[model samples]
Structure formats: structure tokens, C-alpha cells
Target: MMTTTSEIDSIKKYKTNELIDLLRKEDLELYTEDLEIIRKQKINGRDFLNKNKEEFRNIGFKLGPALRLKEFAEECKKRKKRFSSYKTKKEVVLTKFGIDNSIKNIPKFVPQTINISDDDDEFQYCIREIKRKMEIIGPARSSNEAVRCLYIETILVSAILIVKRIVREKIFLEPQREIVDEEATG
Candidate 1:
């Protein structure tokens, strides 16, 4: 069965003794006997998050699933750290303003979509800029100009994806649409 977005979200919010269920959701080839072993172990979310591949293998998971589980654990840990840091920064800002306790209805952070022009000019410009900087710093691994350009473009695109994902996670605050509209009109 295909997992819906809500189902995926619920999966991300894993609870104690739900590691096996998570494995199942990932569509890993797990045996019924493996499920029974995992249930008996009763691993909690925190413990699961802390486990490495070797540790997971020791806990009745096969090598491939163990590796995938370790990756999932790392991703989960990274998300928790990012969220915790965001909360800490928000609290610090609120405390600094002396309105931490007084404010009960703080607005949620919303991500805004930025419209890039439907042309390669901007992307090519970034690639050229990065290539220029790379030349100044040191020679690229490949002496072939085309190869270097391709490498630089790949890095630039990957960086954009990383930033977009971070923003999508609501790690940074943006003005609400209504507030932005009001400011533009006023």
C-alpha cells in the first residue's frame, strides 16, 4: 500500500516499540520471526535513534535493513537537532523582547515561494561565479573546462536543494502573507 503524506508524517513521529512498524513501512523485507524478535526486544525510539548499523544487526535486523535503519536514525537525529535549535532561538528572541510569557498566540512560521525566472541565465551566472572563485582558491580536480563546469553546477544545484529543504522544514521565520500584503499596500 502506498503511504500518504499524513501516514508518513505519523511514521516520523515514532513511539516506543514501533521500530518494527517503521521497518515495515519502509517496505523492507522483514520476516514474521524477525518481527517477533523485535517485539520481544521492545526498543524505544530514543534507543533506536542511537543505534548504529552493527548494533541494529545485533538486534535481529538483516544487513540491508540495518543500514537503512541506521540512516533513518541519523535523519531523525538531525531533524530533532534542527527543531531544537529553532525552538531555542525562538525562545531567546522572545526572552530578549521581554514578551515571552505575555504572548500566548505567537504566529507560526510560514515558508514563502520564490519565483525564479524561467531562464538559465541566473543558473549559468551562479555557475560562472563559483568557477571564478574556485580558480582564485585552487585548481579544480579536472583540467577539462566542461567537466569543471559540470562539477560546479552539480554542487550549486545540490546546495539549492539543501537550502530549500531547510526552509521547507520551517527552520527560519518569514513574514505572514497577510502582513506582507498589508506592507506592500500601505
Candidate 2:
């Protein structure tokens, strides 16, 4: 899901037209800066992959076929997906300088291993250990750590959605909907 501030959802649910009007009233520079950060992150991820093509082959062993770093980098560059404001022309324009400087500071890779002593509950123990390690070491490192954090966040968000669905079913309540009355004039 696209990242939106909590206030945006409140505004969307209660006062959508007012939110649009507010958007028009605000200076575009704030939006532009937000877009720039997104752009830099994408570019950084792409560049990291490009710089360590061989290392990514090792990472692919653990991460599997879904994320091939080299290919992802190439795709990012080709799509020019770095800049968030590209889709919305009203946002400010900054000179494209390839990847951001902060990306260069991050390490390309970190070593990790999964230790399984016996076949008894091996799968369950491994999963538990992995989760534990993720919590402990996730924020301490850079580059690969950041990517791992993103994956963890994605999994957590998906799990939350699943739990929300289950709870909604258990409660026997209808899902909330926002109704817009286009015909109503004040």
C-alpha cells in the first residue's frame, strides 16, 4: 500500500473535497521534497545492486527468485521510477544526479546464517530464530539491513490486514464505507 499520513486518511474519510481544496492552497514545495526523498531511496536501492552485482547473486540464494537485485536495478533505471513527482507535474523539479550521496555510505552486504542442530522442530525453531535475529540486528546495520527491514515491514503489514479481516468476520459487522454526495450543494 502507498504510504500516507494518518491525517490524510481522516481527511479522506470525513472531508475529501476540503482536503483537495487544502492541497490546492498549500505550497507545492512540501510535496516536491517528499517526492525527492522517495526518489533518492529508489535510486539508492538500484545503485547498491548495480555496484555489487556478484554479492546480489549470493543474496538471491536466500531471498529467492522474487528479487533479483541486478535486474531490479536495471528496471529502476529504465523505468525512472526513482522520482515520485514524475507522475504529478505540479511538484518541484530537482536536477537528477543519479543515486543520492547517502547511499554510498551504506555497506553493500552483511553475513548471516541459519543454524539448525536437529530435525526435531527444525522448521519451527528456524523460523523463530530468524524472527528474533531480525528484531535484534535489523536496525543496527545499513544497506542490506534496510532492505531486510522493508521486507519485515511488508510482512507485518500483510499480517495486520489478515488479522483485521478475521476480526471483522468474527464481529459480524459490515465494513465501513465513505459516501460522497456529488449532487449535494452547500
Top candidate when judged by TM-score against the true structure: 1
Tens-digit lDDT string for candidate 1 (1-186): 444444445555666457677777766576777667657787765666678999989978788777877887677666655554555666788888776855675666697666654454555666676777677755667676655755666566645655666477534334334423443531
By TM-score, how accurate is candidate 2?
0.17
- For model 1, what is the C-alpha lDDT against the true structure? 0.64
lDDT value for model 2:
0.42
Query: Candidate 2 at residue 87, lDDT?
Result: 40
CA RMSD, predictions in order: 17.6, 27.4
Candidate whose lDDT is highest: 1
- The CA lDDT of each predicted structure is 0.64, 0.42
- Cα displacement (angstroms), candidate 1, residue 122, comes to 37
Residue 107 error for model 1, in Å? 19
Question: Which stretches of model 2 miss by more than 4 angstroms?
Answer: 1-47, 51-53, 59-63, 81-186
Deviation from native of the Cα of residue 65 in model 1, angstroms: 0.6
